[model samples]
Target: MFAWFKRKFAKSEAAPAQQERHFMRNRTGARMFAAARQDRLGTAWGGTPLTADEIVDRNQVVLVARSREQSANNDYGRSFLRMCRQNIVGPKGVMLQAQSMTARGKLDNAANQAIEDSWLEWGKRQNCDVTGRRSWRAIQNNCITSAAKDGEFMVRLVFGADGGPWGFALQVLDPQRCPIDLNDQRPRTGAFIRQGIEFNRYGRPLAYYFTTTDESEAGYHWGGKSYVRIPAEEIIHGFLEDMVGQKRGLPWMATALFRMRQLGAMEEAAIIKARTGANQMGFIEWDDGFGPETKEKDDEELTIESEPGEWRVLPSGARVKESNPQYPTGEYAPFYKQALRGMAAGFGVLYNNLASDLEGVNFSSIRQGTLDEREHWKDLQEWLIESLIEPVFEAWLPRALLAGLIKVKGKPLPAERLDQYRVVEWQARRWQWIDPRADVNSAVEAKNNMLTSPGKLIREQGQDPQTVWQESARDVAAMIEAYKSEGIDEATAKELVLLSMGRPQPKVAPTGGNTNEAA
Candidate 1:
């Protein structure tokens, strides 16, 4: 009896543990809830299992995602590009500023200017950047925008004789041409290459696969089995990864895809119904007189163009019912907003910014929402600097040095000393304060208290402090010249400017009569 009881109790006692283990299999249940119960819905995740590779289906994902982005009805895709414009690549893009690392010895001003000017001039040249578009701003925008939409961005350094025979030019490559095949991952070596990107054992990318669009238009190229291998140092790929060792990027729109499709369908339906102007539309049923083949006169003549408030003669025993199928009612806006909120979260944008709706928003809420948006934008800005801007700079600086476009201390700098000459910073999009006076007052206080400096404040405004000082000096000189032209002496005009500028000046007698006259 004891043995039988023990055997029976053993099974029952282990059931809860088995259930717990099953629940833990769910992606969220294990960590979120202690006694979570996950039901099997006969899906691949519940009863069946799928690996990450099996689930992602890389080839299909890229094709379908890019196709959907081109679709006219793809509001989410359009909004993503729009978000990229508003946040990532704004009006004035990420700016490069050179700074000296050493305190005593400042960088050669002329060399810094030459480097900046040469890059700007080169950026405007056709074919200088891979796209053959004549603007660095445009190139930066395209790369970042494409990355957000298409998952990855690729650019190759095109140097040597063919590419202008001077400094390097960049060629933006379409990722479709660079296939991410399984066979590429295998090697007798210590590296793994996937989708044209090669990675070392430590998971750092060592190379990339780059080629022009496949010349063969053969059979639609279903399985991308080929790509040209290129070193990683020659290519700049920009993408955000969720996992630590994610080999590739999942579409930024992936999370919102389902909801976006549903929302689009709903909006289209609403628009169609609204255009129909359907008002209490219903049919009069003939219970007794209607035959299978016969058509009623009233029903035949009754089209959507029928005049309203007209009394109609009906057949015998005709029953009328009104089926006012109301769409886009008071509930519609809130429901739509609720759906968009999720999309905005996925896109890392605020609801108002994503939807451009301010129906019920007040100052405090809008301010807070904008603040949250700024933080997200700032994060992206930092990412852009680290990934795209810095690498490009590192590549460009050496090329510029070799091309003799940049001269450090009036001489050609070696590759080894590039770091010393390459000391620089990039500035991202800046915002004007909500209350300018208040914000300025606070900044002034901060500056006076030594909490911050003028340079910091100027940079926050997206203006270079050195440039501001130089321009101010020029303006003061011009002002002094104008005063001198009006009969004031040179010293008096300079003194006036110095006094107005709040600089210490020697004591001077007051003007006798005219404002310009000095005693």
Candidate 2:
């Protein structure tokens, strides 16, 4: 039975190793490929295939319309087409143009005018949807006149349905005369030489290709005879949406997870410290009221009163039947009644006296000093953690562990066990001291110990202890200094020190010298 139990435990231990090997062999390759693709495409490349929603989220469509006041050209048309193709479809997508230009002739003037008029009408109809207007003749006229005289024109329109402005289309009118070099290798023609109206099926004035001539020569014309058609289709549905969604969500998720884990760790640490009798001190307001004191009335003084019917004669002159009357002293009057009346008469004098003391004691001014001190301490702590401790551990520990030179026994050492690791003692009149005798030592001693330890018996021959100590110490000091600057507490500093000490050290090179020479 014992043998079976041992075998079961052994199998369980080996499971992770087997799983790791499988993950390295199978998942690594795919993940690497995806990462590379993402880098190339400027998008997320998770191993899993992209979804439609992701594509849509990533898509960014931008429609850039220029008025006729702006110069028009064939390049605009070409750019529009290129933008659409790259964004809407992958590079392999196809593009098609519906041709609508006829050969120019003397009798074709009226026909040309009719075609132009028809195109303009179509533009007007579509303008409401595309340009948010009823008319855009001025803008279209620039492209048309330029196309007619220059024999080419182009404009830009961006599609942001996918991860980018994906889809694009270029409308080249009078293809026979106004052919555009798709490669952009040729010079653009003059604006007056090319003139022809171009539009998206949706009525957006994509561009206008036209050529202008003297009234004697002819106006621009468009017909079946002067144009050729190309047809193509490409699809990258929801690509943009997916890209945007992933880009926005993944980093946020990563950051949130990291922060939550960090906060949880801190909470755990705080709980453990509290259990172990660690006292955390903070300031609390002491409200021992120091305002004015009130006193109660003592005994009332006796008063003698004389009734209307009986008059009291002077004791020495006239004597009647002996009777005593009490006279009131009025000692039970409300406290501060006279003082309040006096104050009301001369309130400005009291105000001036109080104002002198409170001249500089506004709300903001009162708290500024305390706020500044708190901020300074906070900044110091941040510097210590981020600049000092984090860098050294992140940089050094992994290498050490990978080399079989260090080990972490638990996720976080218990607060009670902390003293067993290191002691950071602060003196009233001197700098802090970190004791080296505990489990945690200075970077130098730790490195030297690691180099000469049993794990590197084969690698050790004539290593320099002093050099190792110096290097290690420098590294450790850098980390400690950073933490100190950031305002990390003594306990955290000690933990960081231990963590640093546990990092791996490289084997020292041999040096030729006297046998008794100190490293």
Candidate 3:
């Protein structure tokens, strides 16, 4: 029996070796793909193909917690939050333009003005947000920051009695209210819950299952089941979807979280070392326990206090060795910059912007980096407009119209033409020129060549083009009147008004000779 068992064990041990050899022999094209080979280098590399929902369900909570902690404590993390808020939402939030038109294809200025004016009023802190504390800009700031830190932002719409005068209000909820692992077999209908989101046969979110009580509240348990079903239409969930079937968002800084933590710990250690070195003058060593023979306690007898410009004579057989500590070595700055560069790349931002270190960057490099970073910010801004702004406006407009809040000349707007009034154009915040002269020259070239328009240029500067045109016309008329009153001719007054408005004058050449224009 012992011999049989020994033979069986040997066979079992040899089987894996034999199988590995066989597998290697069949892999003739293994060199084509280094990663596919089961070689020594690839032994420790392993992965599993998980669905998007499964992966999100498994990692969302942990990633969000770590991201929040980092953003709260780490400088780079906080910088990222600030950058998102400022660049994506800006000081003034995204502006709205109503594009309602008459049947003759002309702009219905009356309806548009009424809608715009009412929207501006409704966007106030006491009217727009359910909590009555966050204005339109603040809500946008929170949405962007929350999405950057937690990977998603959730807002619930309150209407009728629960809302403000316009019968519309927004309630921002913590992403934690919707549990990540709350998968349940939702009754009757073929829908089911995955990561607190209920999906139908087509994977469309039908409803969200949110816990009524927060985890921080008293008597809260992980397994306790108290969920409120909110329909998908009523909830505005904003997240960056990386995959087609992704149900949840992964934090924007998830990839760099580990590096940020490690870098923070390293910086702390370096600071402590430098501080310790700066404070310690030297160390006193006593020869083999032969120290001062004072009546004080043994521990206190060896304790020597020294002050500036003072010298102390040590006891017999004692020697002082000056101490020197070299901390934050030459490699530290390079390592730190390289790590931050990697993190910045992960966060889709410029290293200079992320680290606020513009030491060696010139105009060209800084301009390129700023352009790339602006593109990233623009992408997020577009996402926010589509995911949150448009939907909220669509929902709010109908409620405001029905409640007789939206009016034209003290008369209520017709609710029958809701579709016409719903057409809106959002003007997002734009960056200022880095080199004003160069930028202006390029813009002039573009305008002269018909590559751009006045409206486009005005919009790029974060101003409404139509409003600018009206203001310009009004200012020019006023200027012309003022100039005419000063005994100037009508045509020259118009010309002076144009010149004052920064319009270039038409240069007339002399009779025959070629006119040379000064640059």
Candidate 4:
């Protein structure tokens, strides 16, 4: 009886074990999730639980190298880069407007003007860059172009003696200068340096390690190169982050690179085929093996040149077979277009714009495409402003103030008011209308219906509303005064001013008619 009771208890304990194994077997066999199954289809999906940083570390070098090659050699690659810079930065670049206000909440016009003037001065070609070659606009261009090409750009802030008179300057470094494989542990703080960036336990960047020698120099990779440790505050690294906690940027063209290479190969092969077809007219065969006379003629390298509409008489029993290559056939256009469309989608651009193909596109379609792409450009413009422009301005401001480079009323700006002075706006260049007249009419109608304001309209044109109003007021006043000097009545001068400004002329009372009737 005791043995039987012990056996019964052991069987009960084994019951749960059997149930668990059965559950696991069912889960594996059915695969609660199709993607979780281990089959031939799933085998190709090498999905891993690697973090963003690890993925970037594994691919950044090759990605950047291929991206640069595409930009240098591929026509579409060059177009993408050009479009990014032209649309994001524009010829005039981003405009800065000082919005510093006094304690009374009124515009501090003098201080604002002073700051603007000083900033423009510092933006000159000889002042903005450490190399003294790039102006502020040129620096902006380089930053945008580099980001497009390398997926990131680094600017080192120079202060004090190295910063020239303003005590601030920007140094644009090649992203490669910061080695991607430089990883180590900090001896003092026990922090981690991954991809040349030193980070604390919380993953905040502390400093960046830049190689002393660039890749062009001998021994750049394993030549015992020294690294300069620059604090995180002094380095502005601009990149678009697509994943959470991504430490590095991937090239914009990374996904499209393989497609671009294949497209080039296809086009080259097609061209070669066309050229071969054009060059080789036909082939000739002898009736028998080369006779003594034919061999002698071949040995002498005798050849026949045919002109237009010319015919040649062939030897007896000799026939010609024409070569026709049907490569790059009717299917080629559609396939090439589809490939380009995919590439454009990968690059976040319109296929028509990238390929410059306007076929079958009406105004509505083109307008919609332009509008959609412009929104993407605007997003990037804002990113550029936040990532690169704002930081540089804030860093330069305090230094400029301390160095007495920016003055108000002939006195240097007080450093204590830096926070107040930092209140400013960055305006990116706006796109012009495809049809200016139609756009203007729409804006007027919207305004008439109280749907939009003059300020909003002015802003849409990439100008400050207040600035436009002020300029308009000054111009009208000057015009009115000049008319008065010419003996024109003030009422008539005002009417003329309104007329020139494109305003409807005031209604005049009909002769000998009631004013109420005119109204």
Candidate 3 per-residue lDDT, tens place, 1-519, comes to 999999999999999999999888777666677777776777788656788987897788899989999999999999999989989988789999888999999889899989999999999999998878999889999999889999999999888877886678999888787888788775688888888899996789998987762425543235558888999988999999998799888999999999999999999999999999999888777787676655656555356777999999877889888889988889899999999999999999999999999998899999999998999999988999999999999898887888788888899999989999998899889999989999999998999999999889999998888788888889888988998999999999988877877888789756544444431
True-vs-predicted CA distance for residue 492, candidate 1, Å? 5.2
Q: What TM-score do all the candidates reach, one by one? A: 0.79, 0.15, 0.88, 0.88
lDDT of 2 at 203: 27
Which model, 2 or 3, shows the larger TM-score? 3
Ranking by TM-score: 4, 3, 1, 2
Each prediction's number of clashing residue pairs: 5, 88, 0, 0
Q: What does each candidate score in C-alpha RMSD? A: 6.9, 36.6, 6.7, 4.7
Error of 3 at 439 (Å): 1.7
The models' CA-based lDDT, in order, is 0.71, 0.32, 0.88, 0.87
- After aligning candidate 2 to the native by TM-score, how far in Å is the CA of 288 from where it should be? 66
Residue 158 lDDT, candidate 4, scale 0-100: 86
Candidate 4 TM-score, C-alpha based: 0.88
Rank order (by lDDT, best first): 3, 4, 1, 2
lDDT of 3: 0.88
Better of 3 and 4 by lDDT: 3
Where does model 4 exceed 4 Å of error? 1-38, 186-190, 213-219, 223-225, 289-302, 308-310, 448-450, 509-519
